[model samples]
Target chain A: MSITAILINAFALVCLIYGFYRDRDKAVKSLKKAAKSLFGILPTILIIIIIIGLMLGFVPPAEISRFVGEQSGILGVLLVGAVGAVLHIPALIAFPLAASMLESGATVMAVAAFITTLTMIGIVTLPMEIKILGKKFALLRNGLSFIIAIIIAILIGVIL
Target chain B: MLLAGMFIVALILVSIYPDRRGAVFNTSMDYLTEMAFILPAVMVLMGLFSVYIPEETVVKHLGKASGSKGFFLAILFGTLPTGPLYVAFPMASTLIKKGARISNIVVFLSAWACIKIPQEMVELQFLGPEFMLARLSLTIIFVGLMGFVIEWMMKRTNGVIDG
Candidate 1:
C-alpha cells in the first residue's frame, strides 16, 4: 500500500495496542464500535466507489472538467461548494469522490471548495445548530464558512 | 436510496457497454481496496478517542480557560477525533453555558467540523500531502480568523453577554 496507508495502519495498531494495555474492555469495545460503524457505512462506501469508477473510467478529463475543471473558474468552484454545503455525505466517502473528480479534470480549487464546504457547513444539521447555538451563531458560522471555503479554495488553486 | 440508484446505473453501464465493464469493475475494486485499508483503522481510532476522551472531559478542561489559552484549548479539544459535527453542537452549547468565549467556541466548532486527525489521515491518503497539508494549515488560519470575526459580529449585534 501507499506509505500514508502504511502509516495510518501503523498508527491504528499502536493506538490499539496502547488502548488494550490501558484497558482491555474499552479497547475491545472500541473494536466493536469500529466494526459496527464500518458495517453501517459500508453501503455508502460501495456506492461512492462505484461512482468514482464511473467518473474516472468513462468520463474524459476534458468533459469532466468543463464544469469543475481548471478553466471552469470561480463559478465552478462556487457551484461545487454549494453542493458540498447542502449534501450530507460522510467526509470519509467525500474524499474519494473528491479525489476521483480531481483525477478526472476537476480543478484543485473546485475540489478543495467542495471538501472544505462539505465538512464545514451542514445544511441537514443547521436546524440542530440553530436550536442549540441560536440562529445568529449558526448563521454566522455557516455564512462565514462559505465565504472562507471559497477563499481557501482559491488559495489552494494558486499554490497547488 | 442513492446506493440503489448507483447500482442500477452500474448495471446498465455494464450491460450496455460490455467492453467497459471490466474497466469499471477494476477501477471500483482498486478504490475499494484502498478504502478498505484505511476506513477500519480510522474508525477504530475514532472509537478509541470517543471512548477515552468523553465530552465531560472536554467541558471540564475547556471550561476553565479563557482568552488566548482558551482558543488553543478549543482547537486542541476539537481536533480530538470524535463523532460528527451534529454531535458537537450540543457540546458547543454546553461550552458556552460554561462561559467559554464565543471566539473559542467558534474555533472549537470549526476545528471539530474540518480538522480532526482521522479526517486528515483520509485526506492525506486521497488528496496527497501537499493538498492535505495546505488545506489543513489554511483551514487553521481561516477558521481562527472566522472565529474572531463571528465573535465580533455577535457582540455588535447582540451586545455582550456577561456570562
Candidate 2:
C-alpha cells in the first residue's frame, strides 16, 4: 500500500477506537449494525465489482473509443456528456477506461464530458440517492451537476 | 449455509412466481459475478481505511473552512479516497457532527465518486494525457459548482441537517 493509504487506515483506526473507548455501549451497537449491513451487502457489492471488471477486460476499448472520439464541437460534447450521465461506472474504472478510449483515438472533449457525467450524474444510483437524500435535493443536485459538467466540458473543449 | 438458504428461496420463488423470480435470480447471479472481480481490491481498501485513518484527521483537513479553494482541495482529496459511496454518507454525517458544512461534504463525496486524479493517471497511461487532463479539469469544475448549488438549494429548502 502507498504511504497515503497507510496513513488513512491508521486514521480510521484511531477514530473507531476512540468511538469505542468513549462509549462502549454505543460503540457496540454501531459495530453490530455495521457488521449486519456489511455482511448482508458486501458480498453483493463485491460480486458486482468483479463482474464489471471482467466485462471491462473483455470488451474492446477500441469500440468505445471510436464512438466517443467524434469531436463535432458542441453537439459531440453534449452527446458524449449525456451518454456518461445515463451510464454509471466506477470512477477508478472510468479513468482507465477513459484513458483506453483516448489511446484508441477518442476525442479529449468527449472523454472529459464522459468522465464529468460519469461522476456527477448518478443515473444508476438515482433511486438510491433519492431514497436517502430526498427527491428535491437529489433532483436539484444531479441536475445542477450535469449542467455544470457540460459547461466544464465545453470549457475544456475550448481551453484544452 | 447462507448460499443454501438463498438457493432454497430461489427454488420456491421460481416455482411460485416464475418470471419475476427468474429475473431476480439472473440479476443476482450477474451481480455476484461482478462483485467477485472488484471485491478483493475494495475489501483491502476498506480494511485499510477502517484501520488507518482517524475520522478526526479527515474532518480536520476537510472541514468547511477548506472554502471554495478548500472545496476544490476536498474534491481532489476525496477522489483518491478509496471507499464505497455509502461509506462517505455516514462519514459526512460525522463531519457534520464535527462542524463540517453539508455543502462541503456533498462536494467531497461527489468529487470522490467522480473526479479521482490518481486513478485517472493510471488510465492516462492507457488513454492519453490530454483526455485525462480534460476529464479531470471538467470534473473539478463540476464538483466545485455542485458544492455551491447544493448550498443554495439547502438554504432555500431549509434542508440543512442540524448537526
Candidate 3:
C-alpha cells in the first residue's frame, strides 16, 4: 500500500483502539456505522469507478489534454467548474477522479476548478439550501463559491 | 439506477471494443485498489467523529463564541469529520436562530462544504501534498473572505435573507 493509505489506516486503527478503550459500546457502534455508510455509498463508488475506467480507456491522453490542458486556458477551467457544480458525486470519490484527470494531461487549474466547485457549489442542492437558508443566502453562497472556485483554480495553477 | 445504467454501458462498450478492455479493466482495478486501501479507514474516522461529536456539541461551541475566536471555532467545528453538508444546514440554521454572526455562519457552512479533514487526507493521497496544501490554504483564505463579504452584502440589503 502507498504511504498515504498506510498513514490513514494507522490513524483509524489508533482512533478505533482508543475509542474501544474509552467506551466499547460507542466504538462498536462506530464500526457498525462505518460499515453501513460504506455499503450505502458502494453503488455510487462502483459507478464512479466505471466512469473513470471508461474515460481513461476511450479518451486518448492527447484528446483529454487538448480540452483541459495548458492550452485549454480559462475556458477549460470554467467548463469543468460548471460541470462540477452540476454533478452531485460524493467529494471523497472526486479526488481519485481528479487525480486520474491530472494523470491523463488535465491542467492543475481545470482539476482544481472541478474539485473546488464540486465540493463548494451545489447546484443539485440549491432548492434544499434555499428552503432552509433562504434564497438570497443560498444564491449568494453558491454564486460566490463558483467565482472563488475559479479564482482558487487559477491561483493553484500559478502557485503549484 | 445510475449504477445499473453504468454497468450496462460499460459492458456494451467493452464488448464492442475488445482491444480497449484491458486498459479499462486495468484502470478500474487500480482505482479500486486505491479506494479499498483508504475508503474504509476514512469511513471509520467519519463514523467515529459522527458518533462522538454530537451535533449539540457543535452548536453549543459555535453559538457562543464571537469575533475572531468565533471564526476560529467555526472552522474547527466545520473541519471535523462529521456528516455531509446537508447535515450542517440545519445546524447552521439553529446557530443563526441563536444569534450567531452571519459571517461566522457563512464561514462554518463553507468550511463544512470544503476543507474537511478526512476529505483533505484523501486529496493528499491522490493529488500530492503540494496540490492539496495549496488548495487547502487558498480555500481557507478565500472562504474566510467570502464569509465576510456575504455578511456585508446581506447587511446592506437589510432583511433580505429570511429563511
Clashing residue pairs found in predicted model 3: none
Candidate 3: lDDT of B156?
92
Off by over 4 Å in 3: none
Scoring only the A-chain of each prediction against the true A-chain gives TM-scores of 0.96, 0.57, 0.96
Off by over 4 Å in 2: A1-67, A103-105, B1-50, B54-56, B59-73, B97-99, B159-163
lDDT of each: 0.89, 0.60, 0.90
Candidate 2, residues A1-160: lDDT per residue as tens digits?
A: 4343444345445655776787666555645544554466554444443333333444455665446655355676778888888876555556544544454566777777787777667787777766666566667777887788777776776776
Pick out the ten consecutive residues of candidate 2 chain A with the lowest summed lDDT.
A49-58
RMSD of 3: 1.3
Q: Identify the leading candidate in terms of TM-score.
A: 3
What docking class should model 1 receive? Answer: medium
Best by DockQ: 3
DockQ of each: 0.68, 0.14, 0.81
Error of 2 at B19 (Å): 41
Q: What is candidate 1's lDDT per residue for A43-150, written digit by digit as tens?
A: 999988998888777887899789998788899999999999999988888889998888888999999999999999999999888888888889889999999999
Clashing pairs in 1: A65-A69
